[model samples]
Target chain A: MGVTVLQIFPDSSRSGCLETEKLHKRIMHLDAVQCGMFTVDCDTCYTVTQTGNNRKLHIVHNSETPTTTYAILDTGTKQITLSADYLFDLLLPRLDFMYQSKKNLKIESKGAKYEIGDFVVKIGTVTMSGHYKAILVEVEYLPCHTPALCWSLMREFMQSFMGSCVKPTLPSYLQNRLHDIHTPQDTVQQYVEKFNEIREGTTFAGTQTTGSGS
Target chain B: MAMPVNVPHVGENLEAAMKSQIVPDQEFLLQGSVLDTSLGVVIDRLRGLCDNADILPETFHDHEVVFVLKDFSAMSTPGPASQGVMLRVRRAMDYPDLPYQLRYVGYPELGNYPALLRNCLDIPVSNNVCEFLTELGAKLDHEFIAKGFIMKKGRIKVTVFKMYKMGIGMAKDNLEQMTMSHMVELSVLTTKTDMSVAEDLRALADQLKPLVQLERIDYRRLGP
Candidate 1:
């Protein structure tokens, strides 16, 4: 196994550029990746796994903290663990939205003993790692577009994907929702005011209008 | 034939005898049979047990926990369906001896299943392969559009591994179905992990806590 180092040069200050250039020249002299911890005038360095897929392990930089979170991928186990601070923080918020989606998708129908949605809502099964009492509250069918082409143009890949999918005819409004929090609610009472607010420009996805709530 | 229904007259838990209880041909475990599958009787049967003491809490009284029958579609194998599901219902049922209502919902009917499953075991319509073998073409067609797997040589394959892990494995054996990825996802959503494990235990001692009024206490030292 050979190690290759990719570093970014930060030239925010021209005064340091000359010195940086000299250092850059020195680094370029080493075989693709020169080993031994020697200081390089670079903004960041990335360590990537070289195999069938170059899985990024980590990236380091001069800043006290760096970004682009590292996904802890145990390929053998096929488990993705987000140990990075920013990544973990996003999980709880996603969960809150997921719960709300479950609440909104509760459809009612005829004399059947129970609605099909009931199976999706059954208290949701949570694994013994999260802190909440509920898990998998429900499956939402908000306006969604999953790669689909007419049967004539559908490729084998698309066929495979759709084949595994529970392709139910969902609400048209659901397509635009696949990503938003206010996408769907139990009723329009929850979405009405927000819809009116966005009516002027018909916008969502982080754009706030004149009438905004904290 | 029929499981006993426990109620006020029966003033105690009629613990379900899962032991040596091999139900034959899980054909109509939950489905409305010519022979009525009185689920209400099953729910009534799981009511509170007598310690010669405790009863339901008076103030805010409702079933705190819900029971679910995992990974069932047609019917249970007509006997010890799956220890994984059984062990769980047993653990939760007896957990703290907290009296909670139980319900059973089959898996595939997840459409109706999850809802009916609000928290209990459900019998399935059918599960035996024999029933489908003759209707083999229909099975493939159903699995094709719904499951995206071709049962050639009897091994299922999918474009995505996640679906493969869940749809197929969950039906056969739930134990293998629940992977760590599955757990972390659940933990993120429901926050079911024991809170005590997240951080140091002693650190919590300093916080001013709520006044305690011991409500219902039913602890059974499970094993010797």
Candidate 2:
């Protein structure tokens, strides 16, 4: 089944962004809870399996965490996340891994998540490696799998509080993969783009000193 | 044969029998889901089923944790149906003493009326047994909350349920229902070869009429 999700990005000036207090109050109207996590991607690999579908896996090894090492496997429609040790011990030894992400990004957020009627709303701040980047508000309408059918409803609900932060039309990611099921990979992909942007903005002092011969 | 009106009684050996059970019983089952914009039709059908059969007053509250396993050693089969194997562990909320069951279901194949001939074993396991599957390479899939209302009509087992998707981080209140539509499944489990059972299933399907459409759905064919 497809999930209808709309992501609201902060405005350029941040003036139109909903304040933290207001965000809480808006979410409180739906009676939500605080479900926040600090996720760090230690290693990532993207490869096409023999069945001809693109698959990606991420290994998270954060020391200061209650949970042990784990991995997230994305096959577009379905995202299977399990223990990193299990994947390494049983699965990883056999398959060939492809592209790997070098720079690891840490995202920590404390957001209020609640389901209003049939919709789930998440309003929180996204922090990358200790610096607060932007406020993210996600509204997911669970019932309808087809985005074309539920897009209007999702927009109206999001716009009630987020104002113009949310795009009037379907996001490009959802539009491009309109035929595919919206999995946790969609959310992870957004985080990865932001993480890459952060990585590109800063120059590594060590890499600069140790110049590449090529 | 006439349809039995009484509820199927649980025998004294029910516990002992389940403990020693090993072989997957060769049974024929035809099942489908009902997804309608207005749940009133399905709700009314469920009420009709309740009125016709000897249904228990108590409902089966199921908290199922599904684990999706990928075999890195072998190449995945070339179809959507053969994508991955799923291991489901189910526990009843009311019956904690009752032994939990761990079922491993292979990708269902399409056959006559899309007959899904798969191995379904009911193994008695501890509550924490899922940890063992994870140790063996199974990845954690999304969990869901299902509350089922079971009704028995003669040889048929009718189950109506409301399914909810668990949100990330495992918070109980953070659950989001998959859809407003309730799934209505009609099934019969018998060891003997009975092609006639299909006719019975079809009859039941016909009775539901326009209220609910009970057609075998190939999971692979589902788009998006």
Candidate 3:
């Protein structure tokens, strides 16, 4: 409802005689309104771009229609000419819709993991590229590794960006591993092994290569 | 880079006379804060007069931009401005220097108070643009009115005479364009969450950048 604009490529001319049959079909169904153009008024013309050359056939209808719709065809170069009506009516609505979807959009990529820090790890991929950005959430490979940095890294790494939805159900044993992983000399691996011994299917962070079945 | 200079559309030998006031080749902000509406338009119509003239830099900002009144009454919140300041403005007719106008209104308004005009000048032009508007108000019935000159190179003088006219055509053009545009493009680069609209518009003073020409004085404003 605001403004309409058009952007046209500078060139498009001729629909050769060889393509006469196709050209006849187009004109029979064109919305040729009565419109006189600028100083150089252009009528609908057919164009055929060959591999090495281009051709065209112009159909000049009588100036019988009211001067309402005119075509400003480019005779020289290839260009993108926008329909005036389409610019304001069609494009504006699209832009408004796009803008509506512009806030707090969320995304996710499951089963991914990330190297959170020097001594910590988490499951997820970087969703954004900013200092305070978060990461996409991920599934666990281990139940332990309760370092606060590990938790923070997990929080950040698990936020993948795309669409938006909210849910709250974190991994189990998180509190226990967080406590043990922060201990002075205890390797997080040893704690993870103990957790795994008790619960054989604890998913862990980081890429682990295994050869055969246990 | 230096801003270009152009002499006024009045008098001969005037450029040489003004050149003596300048330091051989230095740009100067040739201001016209007159309430004279018609006179301002005449000066404005000569938009790129300083295009080829040599204007050495007196200040850091480069590129000389001419200011024209989009609406004179816009300056006064009053009707029908004067032409004297615009005429006195052709000071470059005497000096070989670059020129710039801080306040620009098209027609139907000019400053009414003398004190308001004077106070406009003495203040610094860099930090406070509002002060620039006041100085735009400063020239009405001013001490600098009718005649002015630079007391440089120890009394080398360039005489400036003042006059005025009504700029109706220019005013109509400004207002009409304000009301209707052929087309206006919305910015496509907006992010999903941009809260900067209010700030940018505020900086624009609720006016389109097209309605007025506030020439950039600081050419080399450094990094963030």
* CA-only RMSD, every prediction: 27.8, 20.6, 31.1
Interface RMSD (Å), every candidate: 26.0, 19.1, 26.5
Put the candidates in lDDT order, highest first.
2, 3, 1
lDDT of 2 at A57: 65
Best candidate (score: TM-score): 2
Docking class of 2: incorrect
Task: Give candidate 1's error at residue A184 in angstroms.
Answer: 39
lDDT of 2 by residue, B84-141 (tens): 5666888886688875666654444456643444434344554554765564445788
* Model 1: per-residue Cα lDDT over A85-198, one tens digit each: 222222222222111122222111001010121111111111112221111112222232231221112222112222212223222343344343431111221122222222
Alpha-carbon runs more than 4 Å astray in model 3: A1-214, B1-91, B101-224
lDDT for model 1 comes to 0.20
Q: Which stretch of 10 consecutive residues in model 1 chain B shows the poorest summed lDDT? A: B181-190
